[model samples]
Target: MQLNLTGHHIEITDSLRNYVDEKMERIERHFDKVTNTHVILTVENVRHKAEATVNMRGNNIFAESTEDNMYAAIDSLTDKLDRQVKKHKEKITDHHQKESIPLVDTEEE
Candidate 1:
């Protein structure tokens, strides 16, 4: 998966980037169909906000979070994304049973 990380009103450091990368791995591990991901991190006063949009084979999922710490925000954001991805995966996969042929008796008079 390709991750496009961006920061708003804050400078993204190496540690922050690494942390985001590590968290994203959790999502990719479950659903490998992910084609691209865009992440935005922002700080407003005392609130740390994180949001992400994931692009898959034929769908897009978005989620956001806010917390006192950036890491926590990222964690929450990933958790939301994970649930969405799992739901999407289930939707794409078929789980219904196939029909079997039935025997029939034919009589002509």
Candidate 2:
């Protein structure tokens, strides 16, 4: 998956990039079909905000978090994204199961 990282009012450092990459590995472990991800880091006043949009096979997942620390914001953002991916995966699996099995009707004369 392609990861596009952007920084606003903050410089993107190598360690920060590495941290993000390591955390993103969790997402890939859960869903391998992820196409790409766009991550944005912003510092507004005292708030550090992290936002990411993930493009997957049939869905787009977005999550954002604001904290006093950049690392914390990234952690929170990843948690939210993970939940969304799991939910989306469940929905897809449940849909296929429901469609594959047809209900049988029994009639008594």
Candidate 3:
């Protein structure tokens, strides 16, 4: 999966990039269909915000988080994305159960 990182009023550092990459790996492990991810980190006064959009085959998941620290915000943002990806994975999975199987009549013997 491709990761595009952007910053607003802040510089993208290697540590921050690596941190995001590590956190995002969790999501990729859960769902392998991720095509790309666009992440935007912004700093406004005392608030640090992290936002991301994950692109899949036929779905797009967006999530954001705000905190006093950039690392905390990124962590929170990835957690939200992880939950959404799991939910989406469930939706795409085949849910049909044993209802399709026909019962055999014991009286046939």
Candidate 4:
């Protein structure tokens, strides 16, 4: 997956980038069809916010989290994205099951 990491009021450091990459692996383990991911880190006063948008084949998942620490925010954001991807995957797979069978009726005399 292509990751575009951006910082709003904070600087993007190497350690921060590595941390994000590490957390993203968890998401990839769940869904491998991810096309691109855009991550944004923002700092407002004492709040640190991390947001990510995952672009996939048939769906787009977005998640955000805010905490006092940047690492915590990133962790939370990845967790949210992981859950969304799992839910979406389940929906797509379930749809196939629903359409797999057809019902028909025969008249008896």
- Clashes found in each candidate (C-alpha, N, C closer than 3 A): 0, 0, 0, 0
Cα-lDDT of candidate 2? 0.94
Candidate 3: list runs displaced more than 4 Å: 98-109
Best by TM-score: 3
Candidate 2 lDDT, 1-109, residue by residue in tens: 8999999999999999999998898998899999999999999999999999999999999999999999999999999999999998888875543445547766688
| lDDT scores in order | 0.95, 0.94, 0.96, 0.94
State the weakest 10-residue window (summed lDDT) of model 2: 94-103
Q: Which pairs in model 3 have colliding backbones?
A: none
Q: Mind sharing the TM-score for model 1?
A: 0.88
lDDT of 4 by residue, 1-21 (tens): 999999999999999999999
Better of 3 and 4 by lDDT: 3
TM-score order of candidates, top first: 3, 1, 2, 4
What is the C-alpha lDDT profile of model 1 across 1-109, one tens digit per residue? 9999999999999999999999999999999989999999999999999999999998999999999999999999999999999999999899998897677766687
RMSD of each: 4.4, 5.1, 2.7, 5.0
Model 4, residue 20: what's the lDDT?
A: 99
Cα error of candidate 3 at position 72, Å? 0.4
Question: How well does each candidate superpose onto the true structure, as a TM-score?
Answer: 0.88, 0.86, 0.89, 0.85
